[model samples]
Target: MMKIMLVDDDRTMQAILKTLLEMDKHQVVLWDGTSESDIFAQIVQEMPDLILLDYYLRDRNGIEIVKQLRQEPQTSHIRVIMTSGQYLRDECLEAGADAFLLKPYMPDELLRLLHQVQQNG
Candidate 1:
């Protein structure tokens, strides 16, 4: 099972993602905050297989988060999937997200992406 980290400000979304990922037999770690320093630290320490980040955060933007993650050598190789309810697909891709998922995504899509990452990684 892949270890996944989810970062979103919405509790409902976090809960839903946790349920879906766990049902798929993947381990999940969730955070509702947007402190880049803290989150980056955790990512380096845990070294999860994938990271699902929300486009909109309470403290910082997803683009900035992606940029920071990419800039760090330790976390740069981590697969990042950015999710948003409002942003365009190209924007997330341009900001360095490996994949983009719109809000209200199907569980199958998430699982498929996870599988693709696992295979490619």
Candidate 2:
């Protein structure tokens, strides 16, 4: 089972993802979007196998977060799957995400990507 981190500002999204991931036998870690300053540190500490990051966060965009993560040795190697309501797959891939899922995606799509990433890793 993979340890996954869900970083999004929406509590409802977090709850839904947590339940889905748990049901899939993955451990879920929620990032409370309270402070962007501490986000990197929290993620580094958590060191999850994969991060499911939303494209638009309240404090900052996921692109910036993914860029920062790619720059840091502590987080550079972790798998990241970026999600968005808009179509930004190219941008997300350029920012270092392993994959991008447009919001309202099917659970099977997410699971397939998760499995694919896990296998590739």
Candidate 3:
């Protein structure tokens, strides 16, 4: 099973994602990385298999977080899947995200991306 972290400010989205991922047998960690230190600590310590980062946080963007993750050797290699309500694939990928998912996507779509990441990487 994959260990996935969902970084989103929306509690509803977090709950839905947790349910979906858990139903698929993957572990989920719901955190927005609100405090810079929290995300850094969690990523380095927990080292989840994947990070489902929202494109826009209340205070920051996922690309910034992803960039930070890439800087740390311990977290650099972890696959990060960025989700966005808008089309920001280029920007997210440029910042080192492994994959991009548009918002309002189906659970099957998310699973398909996860499977692709696992197979390719």
Query: At residue 46, what lDDT does model 2 achieve?
Result: 94
How many clashing pairs does model 3 include? 0
Candidate that would win on lDDT: 2
State the TM-score for model 3.
0.93
Residue pairs in clash, model 3:
none
**Residue-pair clashes per candidate:** 0, 0, 0
TM-score versus the correct structure, for each prediction: 0.89, 0.97, 0.93
- Tens digit per residue, CA lDDT, model 2, 9-111: 8999899889989999999999967797777888998999999999998869999999999998889999999999999999999999999999899888999
Worst 10 residues of 1 by lDDT: 31-40
Q: Which lDDT values do the candidates have, in the order given? A: 0.84, 0.94, 0.88
Compared to the true structure, candidate 1 yields what TM-score?
A: 0.89
lDDT of 1 by residue, 2-41 (tens): 8999988788888999999999998999873656558777
* Model 2 misplacement above 4 A: none
Best-to-worst ranking by TM-score: 2, 3, 1
